[model samples]
Target: MDNKIRLFTGGTQPTSVGPFAVNEAEQVETRPGNRPSPRELHVTGTAEVSYPADRASVRLSVGNNKTTVNEVTSSVSRRLEYILQAVRQHGVREEDITVRKFLHRDQEVYHMNAEVTVTFSDFDQMEHACSVLLEKLDRSVSVGQPRFFHSAECLNRVRQSACVSAVENAQQKASRISQLLGQSLGAPTLVREDETREWRSHGEDDEEEDGGGGRRGQEAASTQVTPLPRIPSVTASSRVSVYFRMRDGNRKKY
Candidate 1:
């Protein structure tokens, strides 16, 4: 006994059908409405834009270790107060200053630390503040390196411009590729951003100290002989990716 079954499409006389198992004949029916897949092209585009820094930040620290907590706290507070006064005199606004305090107990000694962060929109004012602090403050007070950065508005504007440029770049690339293949680029069927990357450059200078006695004399003499260091400029950058579709010459717009 033969055990073969034949599949047919709309009574087409079996049309050289493939052999099927007896139990699988119901699942082998052919339909006449299947459609072919559409053709597509894939490409990626990227762009980068840079913006200058419009703001600066500096962190200053004061600390003291004494036998009693009150003693340590008072010392740190006094130094911090003087530092804040000097900062404000240099044109830094009170709202732009942030303060933090920490206390720790060690064997037979109490330690108190205070940190003040000042942000400035003007580079000249920031430099003057740092110089004043290093020149008049006590040795116990330490000034950190100034950090430059872009404002929020600047960053947003640059990112938007970069993304737009990237899309334009993608369209130009697709048009050129389609032209080489004798086809014309059509409207974008899909647009996707692969990822966005941000780049920032931070500049740091060596810390300056208010030398005491002989050290101060040496620094004063050196300042007369050495040129001032140049302040570094902060740079912010953005990148993006884009995709577009391709069309035939009959539908080409140009």
Candidate 2:
């Protein structure tokens, strides 16, 4: 029924005798059998690299309402033609632009909608595309922000970089520990790791692109189109567990 003894670091063990606590016993008994043993060191290391995305995906949606389904579809087509022309003028490959979905429905009234998507391999060309599409089309079209992704080659590089950093970090820690305890550190007996991932975003506008573009109010005056900035950085990290064998019967210093 005594909480004091239960809460002690040594708990209710028989050797709860002041300084001769569980910690001391653990150290004293560690080498009792005199068998070679190793100490574990756990630490984290991170590596990051930036590379331009290889591909970009953008979504464009056009909608129209008319008295009949036939009238709605024609209006949608007209709007799409302008957008398609704008995309071509901005250097987008014809094969890269494709319609993802098209629909015409009548629920008492007529409604039509079409979803168009474009893929780009060049970052500079992709940025100015949206504005070009907007300008060429007489009717308004909703454009979604672009999505960017690194190629497989970039991902492989990041993984290799992070693994190297983690090993170096572990070795550095082992050497420091050995020096503090007046002991020599042996080669690493084991190496393991934990993993993490990170993503970053960046944006570039037209006025900022050519160094002479303007805000929305200046759209009419601006001839050079501005493209959204490309996000080019991704990070992957790993933590290592390193074990170093002890030289003699003495426990390695903390």
**Which candidate has the highest TM-score of all?**
1
Steric overlap count per candidate? 0, 4
Misplaced by over 4 Å in model 2 are: 1-46, 50-54, 85-98, 105-108, 149-153, 164-232, 238-254
Instruction: Estimate, for each residue in 153-214, the C-alpha lDDT of model 2 and write its tens digit.
Output: 77777767776776686677667665675666655444444444556445454233534554
What is the lDDT for 41 in model 2?
33
lDDT per residue (tens digit) for residues 41-112 in model 1: 555567777777777788999888999988998888988999898888878888999999999999999989
Worst 10 residues of 2 by lDDT: 1-10
RMSD of each: 15.6, 12.0
The positional error of residue 173 in candidate 1, measured at the CA in angstroms, is 18
Off by over 4 Å in 1: 1-49, 159-254
